[model samples]
Every structure is written in structure tokens, then in C-alpha cells.
Target: MENFIIYMAKASGLIAVFYLAYHILLKKETFFNSNRWFLLAGLFTAAALPLLVYTKTIWVDPVPMAETATRTVTLEQLIAYKQYQQQMAEKAAIEAAAISINWFDVIVGMYLTGVLLFSIRFVLDFLSIRRILSGNIVMKDGRFRLIDSEKARSPFSFFNYIVYNSAQLKQEELAGIIIHEKVHSSQKHSIDMMIGQLFCIVFWFNPLVWMYKRSISQNLEFIADAGAIQVMEDKQAYQKTLLKITVQPDCINLTNNFYQSLIKKRIVMLNKQQSKKLNSWKYAAVLPLLAVFMLLFQVETVAQEKQPAIELIKLPEAKVKFAVQIDKNTQDSELEESKQLLKDEYNADVKYENVTRNPEKEITAIKVTVKDKGQSQVYEVAGHQPIAPFTIEIEKNNSGRNVITFGNSIGKDNFVRAQAFRIDANGDLQDLANDSMHVQKHKIIIGSYGMDGDKMPLRSSVPLKVPEGHWSVNSLKIGDTDMLIVINGVKQKKGDAIKLPLGQEIAELNMVKAKEAKKKYG
Candidate 1:
């Protein structure tokens, strides 16, 4: 919910910035088409800005444990590590306890309730407009539909349908009305209004959104007036028509009414001089503003840097691949499971070897080898631990290639698959199976990656119920190179990532956090 709120706030801020630019720099200009596009592109960009992800990478000194035994731990380093451990422990304790009603939940409840009510209103408004046009509409000149309504003193249009009281109008007034509504229809002004209507439904409480709707409507009117007056032999006659109908009540919200309140501005814009073509450069200013928004609102993932401090071997045009060999004495079930997981998840090739015929003899260390290399990388993992996964990142920044192999193994006896739960704003919890959309709809932030494939691990801020001492949730952070989320207890060897949005109404979530979780849940 917090993340969603921040996104909405940034979205509104961006829209407001664009609208200010339009109002200040482009509003008075006679470039109607350009202004229309500017407004539309600005609104869409603002909405999309929050969904874009950006990354940053920080390189620090290497650790000694992964390289050699001569490394001594510093006091400051130990203190920082202890503090992180304590913080994780404290977080786990708070989340694992039974939740109570809180103010944040109440606020979310109110906001969703408002969304529901406004959504219903939006749908009904559409139906009302449809019902009105369905009746009393006549096909006119085979170009548009005309609705003759006795009570409709002001002319209005929705798409190609025009409604007005023809009986109460003079031929000049009728002509002006048809010409005005034609501009609205031919230009598809109602499409802009529909977009506004949707924003109002989804972000009912956002004042800037309402302001944006008004801006779009006002811009559309400017366009329609500018186009309509061109067809008039007597421009004053059209201005008079606008004045005459300005007092009438507006039609349904979906329709572009001829009698909008901006009569003076419409007349002024109708006579405004054409703007200089070079002034279009003002739109360029929007780029930096959007960049700022991206930096502020992009979701990030933070990973504990746990790569063994081994010197990297740079192989130009050489692809370094990993192969794992399991001892032949391993149980068929465990070995096959590992093989299938490797094949299905990582697409890695696996081989089996037997040194002894005894089934009870424990398999000591799994040997990992870089293809074409003489010495194999010995990974010391217990029979109960899943083999660690590694990635080879080729850096473009003149830095040598890095081969990162995780030191911790995922314990099979303690292995837990990702679990999801449906939580509402009121702190209610129900078990769900990998529903991303549901989690998102409730304003929960799911961790995601930029250069993602179909089989990436799923992470969510929403906590899940897991046994003590296992990874809980996943989040993403941006880096110059693709980094992996390496934790102590659980190993990610295959398609263990969440790909799609969970499709349910989940308010809050719980994820498994391995080390700290062990103390509480265990």
C-alpha cells in the first residue's frame, strides 16, 4: 500500500508538471493538434513512469572468506553485520506475531471503498449516455446520428452522436451546433473523456487526476472551437451561439457539451495568433522531469554480496558454463529430483558417477567444473544441502569478468517452496497459490527484475508463512550487471521465481526470511 501510494503521488506530480507546462507555454498557442498530443502523451507517460525499473551497482572491496583463510574480520565489519542480523531478527519477530487492526488498514479500507463506489458511478454514467443515444436518434445525412431532445437546450456530442433540441433552435444556431459537434465527433474527443473517466474511477481521490480530466476537456473544447470557427462564414455568429448556450445545463459526463463554462477562454483562443514553430521545443523539458520521477519511484532489490573473493578469469569470446556431477551412491529419488530441477529450471547438463557401491556411504562434496578447465571447483555441501547455483557476468566497464558462486547451500531437509497468501487491508489472511495480480491489486509490491526470463524467482514484500530458517520474500535492486538473490538456507537452482502478477485480492503478504525466521518459527 505504501508503494502504491508513492507511485500514485508521483504520477499525479508528473501530470501536474506537464499540465503546468501546457498552461504556461502552449495553452495560448494556435497549435491545437500539437497541444492535444502533448496532453495525451504527458498523461500516459506519468501513469507509466512508476512501472519502469532502473538499476545502480556499487563495487566494494572483496571479502577474504571466499578467497583465503588469512583474512581477519574487522571490528566495524563485525558490528555492521551483527546490526543487520539483529534488524532482521527484530523484523521477523514483529511480522510473525498475530497482527492487529491498525490505522493504515483503516485508511486502505476507506480508499478501496471509495474506488468501488466511484467505479459503479462511472459505469452508470456510461449506461445513461448509451441509453439516451439509443432512443430518439436518427441517422442524418449518413454521416452522424442526431438525437432530437426537447429538453436538451444545449447541444452535445458523444462519438458520432449529436443531441440537441432542434425545435428550440434557429437555423443559424442549429448549423453552428452541428458544426461544433462534428468537430468533436470527427476528432474523437470522447475518447479522451473516456480515459479521464477511467482515471477518475481508479484514482477517485487524486485531485490532480480530476484536474487532468478538466485539462483534457478544456483542450478538446479549444480544438473543437478552433476547427468549428474555420467553417463559419461569420465567426461572430458562432461566438454568439456559444454565449447563447453557455447557460444551459451540461449533458452526461461522457458527452462533450457545447455549453462548457470556459466561454471567454474559448473565444480568446479562437482569435489567438499562431505560435512560433520553435516554441514546440518546450516539450523537451518533460524528459528530465520524467527521469527524476523514475529515480524516485522505481522499485529496487537489495542482495547480500556473498561471492567468494576468488580472482576472475577473463575469457574473451569464451563462454564459461557450469556442470555438476553427483556421487552414484546418492538415492535415486534425490538424484533424479536434482537432475530434473537442473534440467527444467537452469537448463544445465548433469552427470552421475559412482565411486562406491554402498548406498549408506554419505556423498561428501559435489564437484563443479568449468568446461575445458583442468581443476574443478569443489563445492562443499552436505548430503542434505542442494547444490549452489552460480552465474558468470561479463562486465562492459573495463572491469574483468566475474564468476559468482554462492557459498551457502539450500538444505533439502529444510527446503520450502514459495507460498502465497491472500491478505486484505484489514489484516485478514488466506492461503493462495502464486497469485501476483491479486497481490498487486491490494497495493502490495512484488520484487521484479529488469533482464528477466520466464523462470526468474518470485519475490514479494508481502510476508508468507514459512518454517523457521528459510527464505521468506524476494525484492529486486538494479545493478550494472545481473545479480542473483543469494540467501543462506534456500537455494534457487531452477524456475523458482514468480513471473506473472498474482490474480487475487491480497492486501498484505508474508514471505519467508531464512536466518531470522529460524529463531522464531523453529
Candidate 2:
């Protein structure tokens, strides 16, 4: 997560700086400097949106729990259980996935790669242009190196040079034309293009990127106009030259002859603002821009505050024995009844056997056979394992009687165990009727840092009724973490690097509902 944040900050900061640099260094004298306001808008919008929606608490683990009731229900989902879930009519529940997505990774990867590629192209293009322009240089007018017009009235480009139809221009107009194109080179407008390309990629789906590209080019044209025309004191001389070459200016000479970049607009701006002069010291705007941008750099926490912890949590006994059978014929009874049977049968039979000495260990051979007659099925979930708290669904097979398998079914004193619950009914593995069971106020710790994890203090009562057998976790903010719809439960200390995009749909839906309600009632 920290890496992700750093990547985003770097990309954003660089884009802002490049935009500013173009305004201050290369095009300060032209209309380019005047358009810094637009870049400033982009800077504000991109930096603020993510921060505003981010939560205050970012450290604690996610907690997923339903807040229906703390009292036990009348149904018996399992023994030692006061109540079970009551059936609820079928409806769509908000997804409570607590995982986060680091879109920053995508941004960083693309930006860096694009920059490298652009640099390579710039060098190659520069080389080709230099080779062509070397033999064609006729004279230097202000910033432009006027070249010989032998080929045709073509506006061809190679690297920085826009080799123009100099034969069509008068001697005076040629100076102005060379100076204008040269301004483009000296200002490193091509470099700006490379940078703009990255922005184009980040906001690839945004139509605004294309519009902005046109805008930057137009601004550059205006800048070159102002700078080139400034060399001559007589406005009439520059205006005559400008109009003379206006018929067909230089272009990249590609299949698309449409320079919708608005050269006409560039000329008009140059005329209207001809008298205005720029003070180079205006570059001081950089300080405040940097100052404001610094405010946007954030730490990679889910949120940035502390939250309360759970009040009473019931944990299983540290060392409980489990008998797993690979035979797949074990009775699928609930945990309570099975627990009673185990209590009676294995009470005296609970003897630890060392694998080395006991070759004929009957305990290892004992299996809990489960029978399934369904047509099709996929068992994605293996019993929960390390790092990843739960097993991801294996595949999307909706049909079949699938057997839930486990590797570490048995437990010992060293390895702690709990009284596990199993889904007994065949109708649906999930508890759709959520009110079936009720548990007292017991909270699970989540998104923790160490073995002695960071606990979110629980102020509000988060009692549970089994919803779909997985417990209700969505819509509830987990502790202080920026997680929305995180599960409320004890968590193993891992997977802290997850980021902000997880479960965003549920959070947004909640916000949307709140907005609709406000509009309707108010």
C-alpha cells in the first residue's frame, strides 16, 4: 500500500510540475503562461477527489457483522446454540467485500513505461530531423533555423523541425516562420507532448484528454507567435510576414492533414495581446503550487484514525481434536450434536499418538464421512488456511453435491482449535433466513498488525444473526480502517498491503441511498 501511494504521488506531482514548467520556462512570454489556471484546476480535481472520500481511520482490520440482534433465536442451527437464523425473503444484499484495490499500480506502471518509450522516440525522431535539416539550413531568424525549400510546398516534420514551404514565403515572412517553429523546439514542446501522453493514458477514457492535447498545442503556437514577433519593433512588418505564410503552414504531413489544433486561434490571440509584456519573475508561482501539492501526499493507510475494539469475543479452546474422513460418507450433522457425540465417544478415546512409535494408529484412520448425491458441484473453499483467511471459491459450478475437504482436521495442545459449525440442511448451504440464530455481543478483531493485533474498540453493539451462513459484514465500517463492508471477526496477522478499491460498489450504493433519502424527505 505504501508503494502504491508513492507511485500515485510521484505521477501526479510530475504531471503538475511539467505543466507548470511549460508555462514558466518555455512559453512565459506567450499566451501559454496565462493558461496556468487550467492546469491548476486539473491539479485540484485529481488530488482532492480521492482524499475527500477516504475514511479517517486507516489502520485496524476489517470487521463484517450484521447488526440485526444480540438475542439468541428459537431455531436450533446447532447445539449449545440458543437460537438459529429465521428465514428471510430472498433479496439482494449489499456485497461486503473488505479487500481494497490499488489502482495506483496501474497508473505508475503505465506512466513509467510510456515515458521510457517516448524518450526513445524523441531521440530517434531528433536524429532523423537533424540529418535532413543539416543540408537544408539556409539562415537563422530569431530562434528558428530557416531551411532550404527544394522539395515542395510541404509542411513536413522530423523531430523538432517543421520544414516549411519556404519558396512560397517572402524573405521577411521566412524569418518569422522559422522563428515560430524554432520556438517550438527551444521550449521543448515535444517533451511536453511526451508528458501529456502519460496524462492521456491515465485519463484514457476521458474525452477531455484529447481536448487538452489540442489546447496545449494551440497555446504553444500562441507562445511562439508572441516570442517571434517581439524581435521586430515594427508591428506592421511582423503582421505582414505572419499573414503571408498563413496560406499553408508547416505540419507533421501525416495522413491526417487536419490541424484542428487551431492555428487561426493562435494568430488571433497573438494579435490581441501583442502589446502585453511578460515579467520573467512571474515564475515564482511555483512555490505556492508546490506548497499546495504537498498537502495531497498521503500515507497508504485504509483510513487515518483509531477505532474501538470488540467487547466480548468467544474463542474456541486452544487444543481440540478433529477426525476427518476421506471416505466421503460421514453424516453431515451440525456442530453441537456432533460435539456431544465426540464428548461422549472421544472423551476416553482422546489419546495423543506420536507418529514415530504408533504404526497402527486407529485415531489417524478415523474419518467423518459426508454423503452428497447432487449432480454437479465445485468445492472452491478448502478449510480456511494461512495468510488468506478463507478459501476463494474454486469455480462457478452451481450444480452438484460437493464435499468440503480439509488437510489439518485434527488439533493438539500446541495448535489451538475451535468448536466448528457445519451447514446441515441441503436446501441451500447459506442461511437465507437471517433471524435463524442470535449471538450475544461478541466482536472479532480485524486488519491487525501483529500477533498482539491492533483492536478496534467497539462502542456500538454488533450482535449477529447468520446471513447466508457467512455472517453479515457488508455496509459496516470495520474499526478505524478505511474499509467499507469489511468482515467483523478475529483475523490472522497478514494481508495488510491491500488498498482502497475493494467493496467500493457497496459503499457508493449506501451513499447514493442516503442522497436519495435526503432529497425525498427534505
Candidate 3:
């Protein structure tokens, strides 16, 4: 809470200063009519930052299941996992690859910029006030200093510690205005106005807000006059003084005045009958909104911390062998979509890339990289996507790139489904697929597991979230591993290689049997 308050204060202060500078540069005036808005926006934005971060936070699952068809091969059939080993290496990669807005620049960069800009504005205002005070105009050597402004002919602010044109009035007038300006400074009204002006910066388009802001300034004057009544003993003399000062049509709206119409409002307010106040029972009105906000943002404390689910199954000690062809250009601004499984299942991570599109310049035909790995390996970021026939056999084809995924696969229990965890600024993830099997990036292919959610098998889950052109596939190969997965969209991997499984099928018969047994026996 403290940290968010500080940031909010910084944001408010920045906006206040920015508008202050803008007015000074162009209009030579400062307005303070943005009170509630600045306070509300600051509080709201600060509170929401943590929530946004939580939505993007990465989660990983490690699922292990026995490989049924994979047969163990040593120095004899080991030729492949070993033979192809020299061809691939790993480098830095993004799971939710940040195309342009990396984590650092958004969080840290924007914060620094906000703070520095506010500091500069503060210094400039300080220097400008000192210069104005030195001008020695109407109240030479007196505390009150006047500023030339087109917006308010007589509007003045007490924050700068200068009284604008107080010397021009008579002794009685000066006394009243002095009391008003002093009240403004001592009561901390300057800060209120400053904060209000900050709100105005954000809602400059709201005309009602602008009028309300001006009204608030005038009302503050009335309130101050009421306070002055507490000090002055003679009502007639004070009223006379207010009348004299009110004659000057050129009045400063910002600075408290000895003879402002506040005197009339004050008299009226003092004379008016007081309305009965509402009882505390009125508080019930906000119960629904408060309940909603709490549900959306309140963090819950877990009473019993359930251990994280970790499922492991030993392969019959064999590596999978299968083939899958993916279309290039179907994944951009890739995001993770989580699905729940019921029986023993292994997750196959399929990350796509279009690095060939260029980091500094835009181009056609993005390169996608796919790395495949299952939950069986720990401490090793091992994975593979089906390599193009040429890239795998031809020594000259070694020039292509391969995306590195987190150990390749997370984990699973039943079927796989897509929930669309992210979308690019352009709406959907950018598609670069060129293969015939791949969709056109705006359409998504969906298949059902049965009629019910709980009935979805470990092999036949559907695509819950689809972009254009993503279809369904059941069984396929990730590099040398023959794995079954759902297809979302087939995207290109490093250099023109295509690798992405969105709507695919899961064909783990052993796992299916386990689920079937559990259902029948339990």
C-alpha cells in the first residue's frame, strides 16, 4: 500500500507539474480544478499494476508418464538421439516471446521516466516563483505577488507563497484579502488545488469537470470567508470591506481575496437553515461494488497449502519416433493456454517463432523455431521439433534456427485445450503460416472430446480458444519423439521450418486405460 501510494503520488505530482508548465508556457496561468479525478485515477492505476503482472506471470508443469511404444536402444539404435545431438544447441528465448515490449522497459523504464520528469517540473516551478516574488510589484517586499494571466484577470494561487496585487487595495481591503490568502496557505488549500489541477490534466475533455473545478475554487473562497468570520468581530465593517474589493472586475480566481463574492455566499450560508444529515445506514449503498472489487482483486490466504501436483511415469525406456509437418507463419506474440487432464498424460510444449521477420526491421515470411521436450527430464532443457528432412540430413542445412522451449514440455493428465492467454496489439496473434495444413490465422479448428467436459479423454481434447485458421490434429512427431497433441496453428520455426501443434489428438492408450480403470473401479 505504501509503495502504491508513493507511485500514485509521483504520478499525480508529474501530471500537476506538466500542466503547470504547459499553462505557464502558453497561458501564463495555473488552474486547480482536478481534485477527485487525480486522486481516483492515481489510486486505481497503482492498484491495478500488480493484477496485470499476475495475469502474465509464467507457470510450468512437469508431467511424467511411461512411454509404451518407445523401445530402448543403446549404442545400436542410439545413433539418432546421439547422431542428431551435434546439430542442435540452445540460446536465450522467450516462452511468451516479447516482440518489442520486454519486461524491463515497461516496468522499470516507465517508472524512471515518470519520476525524472516530475522532478524537473518541481524545480522549474520553484525557480519561476522566486523570480516572480523578486519582481517587487504591487506589494514591494510584501509577501503578496501578482502574476499576469489571460485566463483569470485576478486569479491567484497561494502555493507559490506570493500574494498577487494585494498592495493596490486600501487598508481595510488589504486586511480582508490578507486573511483569505493566509487561510489558503495555512489550511493547506494550495495542495488541494494542486491535486485538483492534476485531475484536470487527465480529464481536460470533460467540460462539466472544468466548470466544477472553477466552482470549487469559488466555493473555497466562500469557505475561507466563513472561517474569517470567526476572527473578525464587526460584521458590518467586514461586509463593507468585501463590498469595496468586489468592485474590481479584474479579479484573480486562484488567490484568496479579502473582498471576493465569497462574502455574499458566506452571509447566505450562515443565514440558511441546516439540512438534516443522513444516518450511517446509507453506507449500505456501496456494498455490491465493494464486494465486486474485493472478489476481483483481494488475495486469499491459503489455510492448507496443498503440495504441487507432480506426476511421473517411466518410459518402457524408449524414445518416440514419428513425423509431423507444420505450416510456417501462424504464431506471433505467442501465449500459453493451460488445460486440465484427468488421467496420466504428458505435455508437449510447442513454441513458435518468426525471428526471420527481423528484430530491427519488418519483413515478409517470419521464421519459426520449435523445441520439443517432455516432463521426463529435469535440470536439462532438452526438446526438439520435427526438423525439415533436408535440415536434418544436409550438412549445409545447418544454418536454420531452432526455438528453445522450457525443458520442452510441462505435464498433463487428460486432454489438451487452448484458452488464448494472449493477443497482440493488432487483435489476434500474427500469423505467418504458408503450409497447406495450417489455417489462415483468423480461424481456429475445434473438436469435441464428448458431450461433457469431464468426459474429455486424454487424447481427444478440443481447441477452446482459436485464432483464424487453426485446426485439429491427434498424433504427430516432435523432432524424434512420436507424440500426440492438439493443433492450434502450425507456425514456422527457425529459417523456414514449420512447427506448431494446436488442434491435435492425444493417443496414449495406456493412459486411457488407466483413466478407464479408475472410472470403472472407483
Which candidate has the top score in lDDT? 1
For all predicted structures, in order, the TM-scores are 0.53, 0.38, 0.38
Q: Residues 56-90, candidate 2, lDDT per residue (tens digit)? A: 44464223332221111111212322222212212
User: What ordering of candidates by lDDT runs from best to worst?
Assistant: 1, 2, 3
Model 3's lDDT to the true fold? 0.36
How does model 2 score by TM-score?
0.38
Shift in Å, residue 178, candidate 2: 2.9
Residue-level lDDT tens digits of model 1 in 1-522: 888777787777877888888878777787888888898888888788777886666553222110110111222223344467689999999988958877778978998998999888888887877666665758685678888876465688988888888887889988988988899999899998988888777778878778878888888998888888889898999889888756647567777988898788898888888788988788787778776766765746444554423333211121212222244344555555554434442344344443223345555444433211232233334344333342211111224332323232211111112333333343333443334333222322232211221223322122333222212232211122111232323333332432211111222222323343354335
Each model's lDDT comes to 0.57, 0.39, 0.36
lDDT of 2: 0.39
Candidate 3 TM-score over all chains jointly: 0.38
* Tens digits of lDDT, candidate 3, 1-522: 455544454444333433333233312111122322333343344334334322333343222122232111111122333334434432234434546756655655565665566556555655654555454544323454445322333434566353545445566655655565666656667665555454444434334334445544555665566566667676566666666555545433334444455456655654454423342222233345434544554434333323334222222222222212112221232112111110101233333333333343333332323323422211211123322211100001133322222211111211223212222443332222222322233222222222223232222222343323332222211132212221222222312212222222222212112333244333
